[model samples]
Target: MDLFTYYRSTSSYRVRIALALKGLDYQAIPVNLLRDGGEQLKPEYRAINPQGRVPSLRTEAGRVITQSPAIIEYLEERYPEVALLSSDLIVRASQRAVAALIGCDIHPLHNVAVLNRLRGMGHDETEVIAWIAHWISEGFNAVEQLIGDDGWCFGASPSVADVYLLPQLYAARRFNVELSACPRILRVEQLALAHLAFQQAHPDAQSDKPA
Candidate 1:
């Protein structure tokens, strides 16, 4: 597998964590999102993914997959040995709810495109940062209640919820969203930092991370 990724991209980070947790070996193809006015917008990358997004997975058979959620779902189904979702029906739904809450509701609000649009609309840095923080704090406040109190988000083991939540938590901290109110999330963060899979998949551990 070849993973086209940007080190600091939370979407890429989530896929990395999923891959690591599944113990899958793949080539990491770094696409620097910030280099030369964003490499993802270049013709070469656009050819691979017309949307020009990072975290595009190319399988050994030369099939390419896009979108983090879809890629993660493919990985989860393809490699069931390390299940990210629960077998129980209700539990699985709850886990997916958390994933949607972050992926759809929270992450998109602070997406680069959204922030850039805000800037284009004449919103200054302070306002943009505030926009990022407000949504993250609001979403996380709900996530804190949805997840488990101890260990991973769903239970003792990591789930799709944890896979999704951790990346958003990273983004929250990156935007300096106050997290004192989300103790459950903080505890999950601590656990994830200690987990080998999460450690290996972290943005700082990626080869393309800046010096």
Candidate 2:
């Protein structure tokens, strides 16, 4: 299997964590998102993923899977031995809810594309930075309120939600969101940061780290 990913993409980071947790062996095919007007938009990479997004996974069976959530669900289904989703229906729904909070609700607003669009519309750095902070704080407030003081999102074991949460949290930190506002998340993130799976999957730890 080959993962076509950008070194700093949060979506790619989520998939990497999933792969590490599942203990799967795969080749990393780095597609530099910032080089040459973003290689993800180039024809060669677009042939692999027309969406021009990072984390297009080529499975062992030679299928091209796009979208991080779909790819993760595929991994969970194919490698059920690791068991990312909860067996209980309500618990699983809660997990999916938390995952969607980050994946769908929070991330899209703060994505590079959105920020670039803001820039194109005559928004200055201060405006763009405030835009990112506002949306992230909105999402983080919800997560902070719901998370409580637990080791994980739902149960003690890390679930699919954590996979989504961690990367968004990383992005939030990059934007300088105040960690003190979310004690539960800060604690959980610290624990995840210490774990080998999270450490190995960090953006800086990737082979294509910027010099």
* Candidates' C-alpha lDDT: 0.92, 0.88
Error of 1 at 198 (Å): 0.1
- List, residue by residue over 128-198, the lDDT tens digit for candidate 1: 99999999999999999998877888888999899988899899889889999999999999999999999
Best by lDDT: 1
At residue 187, candidate 1 shows an lDDT of 94
| Maximum-TM-score candidate | 1
Estimated TM-score per prediction? 0.98, 0.97
Off by over 4 Å in 2: none
lDDT score, candidate 2, position 118: 95
Model 2 over residues 97-210: C-alpha lDDT tens digits?
A: 888888998898987789899999999999998988888889988988766466787778788988998999889889887768788888889889888888888898999988
